[model samples]
Target: MQRVLSCFFALFLGLVPLASADVEVKAPDVLVRDVTNEVLEIVRKDRAIQAGDTQRVFGLVQDKVLPHFNFRRMTMLAVGRDWRNATPEQQGRLVDAFQTLLVRTYSNALTQYRDQVIEFRPVRQTAADTTVQVRTEVRQSGAQPIGIDYTLEKTEKGWKVFDVVVAGVSLVTNYRGSFGDEIRAGGIDGLIRSLEEKNRSLETPQGAK
Candidate 1:
């Protein structure tokens, strides 16, 4: 679990400006390679990030990484079948909580960056396709390579990632079970509270460690 989380942050090593207003079929592939290269440089050179500066890392993630993601879709997917039952306000809260949880989680893992290299695999998609998967591998020293895949969809603005797959484990899939349990145990509000509590812990001095 720790290793997978560590490699997951490997994908955020780059922070380039967004792709064109309308991303092409090959845009996701290019986005992965280009952003990873940029993020590598950021991680490699940023002293604050390397030193585990939570605010700095969080800021970078919010400004650079979050923009490329479709957090609403991600939140809905993780919430599973209960999504339709969630009210508009509840859904909004869920998105915020889920997004915050991911940002903090990835930010912490990002401090473990160590000049890892990413190699993107060929994208298999037709030109007319609206959704596609961008595959890649993370190469690290003294460790086995890990598979990282991004699932992106073409929106009116551009290509945005909805989910990330580490090895064969889907980010949404992994969260769905736990989130479902929370919803069943305490309802949507309960799940929201749980996520909010988790995010609050990450904000504390001890949780930052």
Candidate 2:
């Protein structure tokens, strides 16, 4: 699971931009392919990101990739039944914490890129379809290729990614169990604190750690 998550991050390095003028009109598959190539090139040349400058990576992610994700939907899915129980304010906090966790995870993953090749598979969709899965494989030297799939839905703004499946394990599902456990232990606030703490730990300087 850990290996899949790590490799998924390296592949994820490419799917960051929705700010492009034509992205709104592009098909989901094209969007993924084009953005993947575009961002991979950026990562390859950015010395700061290559040198492990997490702040730069974080900013890049915040500015580029985050806009394309449906994070509220992601938090709701991960929280499951507990989502309805959370007050609006609690739900808002949960979304913020969850987004922070992913942003930090992505920052760490961005630094681990090693020229892994991404192969995007054909996406099957119809004009009536509202949701579609974009399948891709990450190929690295001396290792088997890993499958990474993105679940996206067409929205008013554009196509937004709601979940990612790594090696057939859904990212939201992976977190759901742990999130459920935390909610059971201390309620929603407990889960929030737990996520916040995790984010803080990730934020700590390496020298301090």
Candidate 3:
């Protein structure tokens, strides 16, 4: 699961600025397919990212990939019922910390890119539906195909991804157990502090390690 999750970040590579404007009107599946192609092309051509430029990778993710995600909702879901126990300020901190943790932890995936085939399944959704799942599969030679599914909601801004399930494991759910442990040990503030520490520890590039 961890290996698949690590490979998942590679999909975020090479996001171009031009795609931002069209996101609001594009269907969920179309958006995923287009962005995946754009990102893959950029990753293939950028030598810096291929050489493990952590700063550049992190910047691209913050600028391009993050806009497509609803981090606050992701954090809330990951934290489960404990989310309501947090104050507004603490909730904001949790969102920031979780976002940072993800970016820092997976930023190095830019350097690990292999030419894996990505297959997008036909989307099942209607115009009246506000939430939909965009399913995809990653195929690599000698390995079983891994399923990656994006759960998105139609917000005023566009379709924002609130959760990702990789190989049947929900990303938020994967963290929920550890988050619950932290909250039980020290409260919401403790979870924020723990995430901050994890982010800091991951500041160095994975390649460097």
Candidate 4:
């Protein structure tokens, strides 16, 4: 009985970290350095970011970060099978909502920057001109290290991140099941409502920010 209980508790703790674990992500030399340095500078230099002006900070994210990411793919993945059901207009709305949610999320995350050190690894790219993986490590003061891996696809403009792996888990992949649950329950609209509620909570001053 005691052993079984202990095993269950251990499994729960593992899930805690696994669900939101900030793994030490490693990136390629120049790319990792450039990204970390840019974010760090924004944290240090941006007045609105320092002041917790999330609206403006998110505006910056729209300009700076969003351009580097692949929102269409991300949106499609998040919406899951609902994608097949939605009209083009509904799909567009879902994409916009998710993009806003992510931009605001990064803005908030950036505001929490105390001091994080990072190490970049070599870039292992594929022969095809379509994809590449950039890895990096985020070292904090006293917490377990976080690993971040960026999966990039080459576009006409430049490289765009389609997925970000925190620890070894893919962010989009992790969200899929939960998102699917919402889609199953409330459909795409339900998922949108949930995301809106979550974003609203972020706008409020409180926990785990």
Choose the strongest candidate by TM-score.
Answer: 2
TM-score of each predicted structure versus truth: 0.91, 0.95, 0.93, 0.76
lDDT by residue for model 3 over 1-209, one digit each (tens)? Answer: 66877866766442233566787767888878887887787677888877787887788788877887899999999999999989999999999999998887668766778688888999999889999998988888998988888899999988888888888999999999999999999999899999998888778653443
Where's the lowest-lDDT run of ten residues in candidate 4? Answer: 11-20
Local error of candidate 3 at 79, Å? 0.5
Between prediction 2 and prediction 4, which has the larger TM-score?
2
Computed on alpha carbons, the lDDT of every model, listed in order, comes to 0.81, 0.87, 0.82, 0.60
lDDT of 3 at 44: 78
The Cα error of candidate 4 at residue 50, in Å, is 3.0
* Ten-residue region with minimum lDDT total, candidate 1: 15-24
lDDT of 3 at 27: 84
Lowest summed lDDT across 10 adjacent residues in model 2 is found at 200-209
Stretches off by above 4 angstroms in model 3 are: 14-17, 205-209
- Candidate 2 residue 150 C-alpha distance from true site, Å: 0.4
Q: lDDT at 160 for candidate 1?
A: 83
- Cα displacement (Å) at residue 67, model 3: 1.2
Ranking of predictions according to TM-score: 2, 3, 1, 4
What lDDT, from 0 to 1, does candidate 2 have? 0.87
Residue 68 accuracy (lDDT) in model 4: 58
lDDT of 4 by residue, 1-209 (tens): 22222221111111111111122232223444555566565466766556666666555556555655788898887667778897787788778877776666665665555556666777766557467777766676887666676777766655567777777777677678888998889987888788878777767343225
Compare candidates 3 and 4 on lDDT and give the better one. 3
- In model 3, state the lDDT of residue 78: 98
RMSD (Å) of each candidate, 1 decimal: 2.6, 2.0, 2.3, 9.9
